[model samples]
Target: MQTELTLNERHLYLHRYPTRQNETLQAWDAGDEYLINHVEQLGLPPAQNIVIINDSFGALSCYLSKHHNVTMVSDSFIAHQGAKANLSRNQCVAITHLNTLNELPSDTDLVLLKIPKSNRHLSWILDKIRNTLPANCRVVSVNKVREIHTSTLKLFEKHLGTTTTSLAWKKHRLVFSQLDASPQPISPFVEWSVDGENYSLKNLPNVYSGESLDLGARFLLPYLPKDERFKRIIDLGCGNGVLSVKLGQLNPNAEIIGVDESYMAVESATLNVKAALGPEFQFEAKVNNCLDDFAPQSADLIVCNPPFHQQLAVTDHIAWQMFCDAKQVLRAKGKLLVIGNRHLGYDNKLARLFGKAQLRQIAVNKKFVILQATK
Candidate 1:
């Protein structure tokens, strides 16, 4: 994959966060390039306070920060780390990095957005902009032409203001919206109870399966390994901490930890776990890239519902990396329990990582499978 981004006679070396030696994907896509090129052509005055939302890896900030004060907003911890690394690698000016939960800067003159895959997330961001930022701020967004639809544009118009789209370039398109909409109350957190369980889960806007229990998780719930011998349990990619909460109930003495990349996901998980297990429960929800910072052989049990995609890109690299990390962190004879769609072929991947003899199918349905691998 290309690491150098050449725009306007300038070159910036960029990489995705937790840079992998065999990474096949580039840090930025055509949509990112389209947005950067369009902004450069506009020749916005220097010193303008610019807010860049959902930048995958700081491509927009790395380019614009040289001339303008930039505030990078994202819901991803990994994306923020990537942006920071790329900024340092390119020797770009230091720019502000803000999580999605933070209020948009009121002084922002321009907003550059990379439309997220989740419309709920997009609506949440647009709501923040409408409620906090000035109505005159120009919001320019970019996405693959195939991803944007009439419904997507309607979201922009409904939450922010009048919106328009540019002609497709390189299979990508730009959306322009004027922030003229009246401020509306932000949506409330989604709350739901697990089937046959009294525990209630509260999900922030960007949390995975926010509206209900994920189907895979629902399938895996009956198979979750419960043992008092599990001293340190991890819920990898824990969305709303439902699995962590369940594990806590089964093995009350085990310390449960939830790890996810999204800031909103981690926050929601933290809240849900606390609400379910009480404030004194031994639980921790962390925003991280898989288990990159985890100590080797520190976990006794790791339960995962691996995601097949990151942002809008459908890929298996993340699931692969999570499996590898689980192998590194699990103690001797410790187990990693994973649930995923059958077509993802996680069984073959786990067999390769943990050896065929160490992996076994715990349960399987028509659509999903729960596999357990022993370290």
Candidate 2:
């Protein structure tokens, strides 16, 4: 990954994920650069309270903290870990960290937000800021120019007062708005019922497969390993806890855990599991990236419908890391079952980690293939 970020008369050394191996991928993107440059160009005064939302890896937080105290908000566990590591690596001071679901810290004098892909979630966040921040707070949101649309503008206009967009520079655009007294109500949850499943699944605004089951996960459901001997099971990348809830229902004695990086995903998954499998079922859902801190040989079964993309970037590094984590965490003779697209070549990747991986054709689908690896 690129080590040095030089723009707007400042130099920053940053890395994404803290373990990013590719030399070309930089931690901060053009949007971040545009936002930072715009802030510098505006000659904004030192903020009494500066809040940064969706800072991918401490780029905005670290740089902005030098000028003003910062409160960083994020949902990804990996982002927090990476931000902390990068901040320490650069010898920057620590910033207050809060999850997106948590309330904003103090009254915001200025907000620096990075717009995400989910428009509803963006609206939800806008509502949050409108309701939480003090009146007349300065809000500046930045995104790729392509992401700036009618709804984006409308959201800011409605939640904040008199929103305006800056001219595009380096394929990025910046939005400036001043907070108003009117606070709009927002619902962060969505719901859907799956056929043949006994219960409805709940999802938060940013959770994967927002209101419905994903096609890949739909293809994976019937193939879930149902064994009587398994005592511990993990639903890797358990979006909305569908797989974990299903497994828990099938094997009532097993201890089930759902893991994901998104806080909304974890919260939705926990709710979905308990709603589907009754409150008595023992299950846990947590926000984590793959398995950075998981114990070795702890799981008898690991099931995953791993995600291939990280936001707008299409990459398999996350899935590779997840498979490696599964291999390390599974007990002796335990199994890891994964459902992935055929074009992705997950079988070969799984084989690279596990000495061997076997593939089976699950009925009713040609786009996805189920691969199982034994540790």
Per-residue CA lDDT of model 1 for 133-187, tens digit only, reads 8878889999888999999999999899889999999999999998887776776
List per-prediction Cα lDDT, in the order shown. 0.91, 0.84
Q: Which residue pairs show collisions in model 1?
A: none
Task: Record all residue pairs in model 2 with backbone atoms less than 3 Å apart, i.e. clashing.
Answer: none
TM-score per candidate, in order?
0.96, 0.95
Tell me, by lDDT, which candidate is best: 1
lDDT for residue 330 in candidate 1, whole number 0-100: 97
* Clash count list over all predictions: 0, 0
RMSD of 2: 1.7
Model 2 Cα lDDT, one tens digit per residue, 173-227: 8899887637878777888887677778888888888867899887777777778
